[model samples]
Target: MLAHIHIRNFAIIDEVELELEGGLTVLTGETGAGKSILVDALGLALGDRADAAAVRHGQKRAEIALTVDVGALPAVRDWLAEQMIDEGDECLIRRVIGAEGRSRAFINGQPVPLASLRTLGEQLVDIHGQHAHQSLLRGDEQRRLLDHHGGLEALATDTAQAWQQWQADRRTLEEALGSREERDARLELLRYQVEELEALALAEGELETLETEHRRLAHAEKLAAGVQAALAALYEEEFAAQPVVARQLRQLETLAELDPALASVRDLLKDAEIQLGEAADGLRRYADDADIDPQRVQWADRRLGRIRELARKHRVEEQALHAVLPELTAELEALEALDAKLEHLEQAVERSEQAWRALAEQLSQGRQQAAKSLGGEVTALMQALGMAGGRFEVAINALAPGKARASGLDGVEFLVSANPGQPPRALSRVASGGELSRIALAIQVIAADAGSTPCMVFDEVDAGIGGGVAEIVGRKLRELGERCQVLCVTHVPQVASQGHRHLHVSKSGGRQTRTKIQRLDDTGRVEELARMLGGVEITARTRAHAEEMLGQAAQSAALRRT
Candidate 1:
């Protein structure tokens, strides 16, 4: 339920705060007193499209804040929790529109997209605009009302899900059973590619090892020649350096016997000779083992060329080709099993179609049953609303068998006969403006029984209705209020008198011309009602009449409870 609204700098409304109630509440004002501004402010807080022109002249921005109780609304509570904006028992929505046409919205102090606000707003309230009742004329809204009233919403949802799954299965089957030419071409290419990759049979790191060996073999001749030259210069030649170092070491040893210092010198020379001999032996071994095999180099080149050629064919690097091979093999395997996959998809489609048909049939039956009961209820309500003898009907016709749709396979429209002996016709064709308002009100009263909204805003629902008919509409609205909180903007004295609480909007202040609202006391309400009854003046007779209407309304309300 709407707990409060605070609006500032909106149109001519400089600042106005209101505390709303649960039962029937009415807003009545003069023609230019800015009642519509308040309704527009409420709409803004509920995520309606913003307009910069609605901002007060010379003001920088307009702001609206709405507070609502969500303790009894589990869906709204859950949504707030999902958005991480759940307060203990209340949800506060704030909307701000800048003079430059920019706007921002928030829920419970957390910034949110307008769409989130819209989604949550729908659960909390249903605001019907001027002529919004005309939406009843649309077939889609009619079907939704029927389904909701019939308690077939769940089955309708199931049908949509099943139909989607069935369509997905059909698409899968079509792809699997591709054109014959395309399938044959792909199969041949995959088979050959798989065979070629398997034949290569390369190891993980074999390429790097092979490349090193090839480089070594290709330079073997130069390496062998350098090795033999080093050996000859060291020890393999006729007067090798090792023999000279040996003779010097022997002389030093003989001299060392003569003197102690000479002995240290002889040991150093002997260690050098030993190092030289080891170096000579290592060079000789290398010369004997050096190889210059051209044939092996040619073999290495051929192996590398084959690997590169395969890499180019597959559009991958030589190293990455190994990874690609396994993936291709998997694809080829799937192609080979195409027949089995096709069979499975076809069977899945059939199963989903069967499930969808069963749910659709159930939904259709429920709608048919609900249509009859709803038609009867609405027709009776019309008679009570001053359209005596007017009849309402719900016309349900089946769609063609092959036309698959998310909203079951039936077309629903509202039909009516406004007078005695008149043939029933479509609602739009048979009802005039005033009759349409009554008809729409009658349907809404019945639909309200199944509605989940906690608050209902009927903006000018009494339009094109007056006299006793207007009072009856007020009573019907009050009856709806018993189920949910109601907010009505009315110009009818009869409706205004019926409100459990009333607010009078008046424009004052000369230069600024600001709009203000006040909760009416008993005397204040009488004066306002008298103003509505008479034109610009309130006489004694109008005052008496207004007082009598209030007494009658109060008595009527008291009797309704019992």
Candidate 2:
């Protein structure tokens, strides 16, 4: 239920904060007094498109915020939780529209996209615009209303998803079937590529190893000469380091016997001689073990050439050639299994089609059932709204199989018979403006009652009707409020008097005209009602009439509660 609304610098509204309660609440004022502006501002908070012109003149921006109780609304709570912005039991939605037409929206203090605000808003409030009846003439709107009233929205959504999936799969299968020659060509190419890669049989890291070996063999002679020179300098020559170090070590040893300090130097000379000898031995072994055969050099060159040639052929680096094999092989395997895949996709398409058909059928049945009930209910409401013999019917026509749509296979239209003995005809064809308004009101009331949205806003729902009919319309709304929160923008005194709470919107100031709204007390309601009944004058008779109307409305409400 909507708990509060705070609007500032919105249109003629300078600043107005209202703490709203459950049940019927009405806003009434003179023409251009900005009663409907409040509803529009509420719409802004509920994610309606913003307009720069909606900002008050000379103001930088317009702001509107709404607080609603979500304790009983699991769907709304679930949405908040999914968005990770849940505030226990209450939801706050705010919108700001800059004078430059830029807009920002927020939910639970977290900035959100307009679409997210809209998505969550729908579950919390359902606004019935003053001109809603205009859109009701469209076929799509009629279908949507039927679906919404029937509680088949989820089923319809599932049907649409299934149909889309089936269509997508069909397209895929058709594309595949159309390209058989291309598939055959691709298969041939892939098979040859896979065979070529398999023949190479390259192993991971093997290329690097082969290249190192090839470099070693290609420069073997230079390496062997370098190693022999090193050995001669270290040990092979008679004046090599090993012989020099041995002569030095014996001299140091003789001196160390006379002086202990020279003993350490003698040990160092001996260690150096031993190390030099080991180095010469290592170099000699390397020279002996080195492979310097020309045949091996040619073999290494050929092996590297093959690997590089294949790498260039595949447009890959020699180091990456090994990775391409598995990729090509996998594609070849899949292409070889094309027939199996085709069969599987075909089966998938069939299953999706069946699923869509089943869901559509269920939706159709549900609509049929709901249509009968809704038509009967609306026809009854029309009777109370001064349409004595008017009849309402939901016409369900099946579409041809070739002309299927995602919503369902059935086309929905609202048919009306305004007089007894007249055949029911399309609303647009037979219903007059007044009749349309009444029918629209009846349908809206029924739909709103059936829906789960916690709050309903009806702007001028009693338009085109007056006298006892207006009072009846007001009664219907008040009765609806008994179940949920209701906010109505009304001009008729009969309707205004029926509200459990009344707010009077009045404009003041000359060039800086601002709209102010205040809740009405009993005396205030009577005076306001009298003003509505009387034009620009308040008389004793109008006051008495207004008092009577309020008295009757109060009695009716009391009886309803009982």
Candidate 3:
């Protein structure tokens, strides 16, 4: 239940606080007295779009806050928890619009996105605007209204989910089938590419090894000449340096026998001869091992050129050329299995489509059953709301199976005839705005009786209705209040008198006028009603008449319980 509402700096409303109660509460005032401003203000708290013009002339911003008693509302509590807001028995929703058109929303004093506030607001209240009947003309809304009334929302949801699943599966199947030719062409290309990659078959590190070998073989001639020169100097040449040094050593040995100074050099000459012998052996071995094979060098160069050519053909770096082989092999495998994969996807699509149709069939039957009962209830309600001999029907027609729609297989419409002998037609075409408003009221009352929303607000639902019908409308509204708290904005004294509580909206102060809303006591209600009864003047007769109407309204309310 909406427990309270506070408005500050809103258009023509400087500050107004309302302590709301559960019952039929009516707001009555003269024309242009801001009777509907309360409704507009409540809309803001419920996350309605705000504008700078909504703020008062000199105020920085306009603020609207609503306090709802949510002790019995677990959805609201859960939502608060999900939004990370402060939790309690009551939830406060506030919205503020700056003078620059910027806006903000808060729940339990925690700022939140406008969307979060909107989602929670939808659960808390259902406001039936004066033009609600216009929506009744729409088949989609008609179907939704019927579903809600019949408690088939779960079935509707199941149908929708099934349809979406079928759509997704169908998309996959279409893609697989649509690209069959392309896949075949790709299969041929991948096979050829894979075979080429496999034929190259380059081993890891082979390229580096081949390059190193190629460099050494290409320079083998130069390497061999250097080794031969060293060997000749050490041992090969008859006039070689090592031979000459050996001859000198022999001469020194003879001299050393003659001279003692020369004898000391003999040990050094022997050491030099030993070192030269080792050097000559090492050089001779290297010269023998050197590879100057031009044929082998040509083979290495050809192999490296083939690898580079393959790398270029595949658009891969030489080092990464080996990595491409596996990817091509995988693609070839998938192409080989393409036919089987497509067959499997086709079966899945068929299964999902069948599932959606099965659920749609159930929903269609449920709607057919619900339509009958709802139509009867609404038709009965119309008679009580001043449409005597009226007929209301819920028309359900099947659409082609190939036609895809989220709302199941049947198209639902609300048809109405306002008088006897009149053929039933679409509600929008058959009913005036006044008739539409009353029909909307009847539907809401029926929905409320079936245990839907706990709070309903009707702004000027009594438009174009008066006389005994106005009394009936008031009585029905009061009765609806018994099931769900109802807030009505009206100028009808009959409706105003029937409310358990009443509010009077009027301009206060001079020059700079501001809207003032005050909850009326018994005397105040009577006075307000009298003012509604007699314009500009509250005569004694009007007061007496207002009191009489209130008495009769109370009596009528009692009889309804009986």
Best by lDDT: 2
Give the alpha-carbon lDDT of every model.
0.85, 0.91, 0.85
Flag regions of model 2 displaced more than 4 Å: 174-178, 185-332
The root-mean-square deviation over C-alpha atoms between each candidate and the true structure, in angstroms, is: 7.9, 10.1, 5.5
Q: Total backbone clashes of model 1?
A: 0
Model 1 TM-score, 2 decimals: 0.73
lDDT per residue, candidate 1, 1-562, as tens digits? 9999999999999999999989888999988899877887888888899999978999999999999988988888888888888997888999999999899999999899999888888778777666766898899988888886786776888988988887888788777766746877888998898888788877788888888888878888777788778767767677777777788888988888877789888888788888887887787777677666778889889888988999999998988777867888899888778757777888998998888888888888999999998899989988888888889899889998788587877888989999987988998898888898888877776776667789988778678888998898888778778788988899999888888899999999788998989999999999999999997888999999999999999999999999
**Per-prediction TM-score to the true structure, in the order listed:** 0.73, 0.75, 0.77
Q: Is candidate 2 or candidate 3 better by TM-score?
A: 3
Better of 1 and 2 by TM-score: 2
lDDT per residue as tens, model 3, 149-176: 8888878998899889988988988887
Candidate 2 TM-score, C-alpha based: 0.75
Error of 2 at 519 (Å): 0.6
Stronger candidate by TM-score (1 vs 3): 3
